[model samples]
Target: MTLTINTDVIRRLRDALLAEAATGAGAQDAHPHRDAALARVAPFAETMYLVMIADGRSAPQEIAAVRGAVRLLTRDLLEDADLDRLLDACAAAASERGAEVMLQVLGGRLCANRGDRETAFTLAAAVALADDEVTDSERALVGDVAEWYGVSSKRARELLGAMQSTG
Candidate 1:
């Protein structure tokens, strides 16, 4: 079987995701805060591209779905100072380590919000798995953050395993 990949389709998927994230379910005025938050992530647009390319072969529809889901999840997970810091960190990191780093920073913010260090680490690990693979460095970063968040080493490993399996 041959899977045809079009870069344009991926671009559209990314735009759609940003659009969906920009607009709420029912409201039409637009969520300024959400817009601002999305703007922060805007710098890492290439990350989405990288994820698509890294997958080797992907249906445009699949790309669209993932983009939409990511936007929704991000919009829902962040708020207030957490959101601000997340956006700032993402913007800064985008210039340095690129979008993957942004994803890791996001995971950290989510973990901080939940106050459940283990879950946060799991979520971050899961995000890394979004492209169907996680680098050793990414895993190590997740583990380190998990530890900083007060997750036990064993529990962090267990959660990472479970999340990766499920993902």
Candidate 2:
């Protein structure tokens, strides 16, 4: 027997799935808990994207590492496609509003809690080291992210130390 592929059927199924996902996400505002959680997660995820491209280019390994970190952080609520879409949206915003502006916007969404700020800074610093060697630019961006989130230098050191110990 010969194997047959039906591209049209595959396209239709893909569209259907995308529509369903969109519909579910459209109701996000109807659920305050989910909306709040997403608001927190969005900036964290965007912070990783910003750090990944801090060196003017993003490495595949860095992208993969960010994806893994976000997946683990969100308990895999975001699939690979969802993460890619997020990164795309981030890139668009950075281009449209500029990276500094985007960082300012994202920093505003970290729930205003010290813990969240620290975590964002820590995760962002970790993302900077995703490619094994942190460039000067990436390091600076990490520092900027920490500062943007109001993470004190002492707290930043502690968070980086913990990340280094574990990573």
Candidate 3:
């Protein structure tokens, strides 16, 4: 048996592997923290939107609040079309998985970071009060989110109050 070694083939393979590595590294470097921040906030947005739906209806204001919060949190990292797509996906997930699953995901994500949990609670409160009044069911949902976020009831009240007053 005779062995044939082609330098051109070896060089081409090495170049391809290097190119792949560079491409991956470039993507990772492009927006290192943005993706992570978006992932952390997304569950909370979906959970907040679901809270409104818990009463069997999602008001336009509630949906708008979700869109605004997701937009504010994501900022330049997402385009309008991209935000709408992501929000739609989140809403679908909530609809398919049910409230318990949504709560678990929301709680897990919020618990990962204290600051995020606080901000999430504030955002949820805003959504709850978007229509100018929080229904009994919405109140209960907000309470559940606060408890899951480890926010004291009093503090939750204070945060919700501040958000309401500012609005």
| Weakest lDDT window of 10 consecutive positions for candidate 1 | 1-10
Best by TM-score: 2
Candidate 3, run of 10 with poorest lDDT = 1-10
17-66, model 3: which lDDT tens digit per residue? 33332332122233556567567567766776777686778877666666
By lDDT, the better pick of 2 and 3 is 2
Instruction: Please list the residue runs of candidate 3 whose C-alpha ends up more than 4 Å from where it truly belongs after superposition.
Output: 1-37, 162-167
**Highest lDDT model number:** 2
Which portions of model 1 miss their true places by more than 4 Å? Answer: 1-28, 32-89, 93-116, 161-167
RMSD of 3: 20.8
Task: Give the local distance difference test score of model 2.
Answer: 0.62
- The sequence of per-residue lDDT tens digits that candidate 1 reaches over residues 81-156 is 4434543453455557754565555445544454444434443444344444444544454555554455665555
- Scored by lDDT, model 3 comes in at 0.61
lDDT of 2 at 36: 50
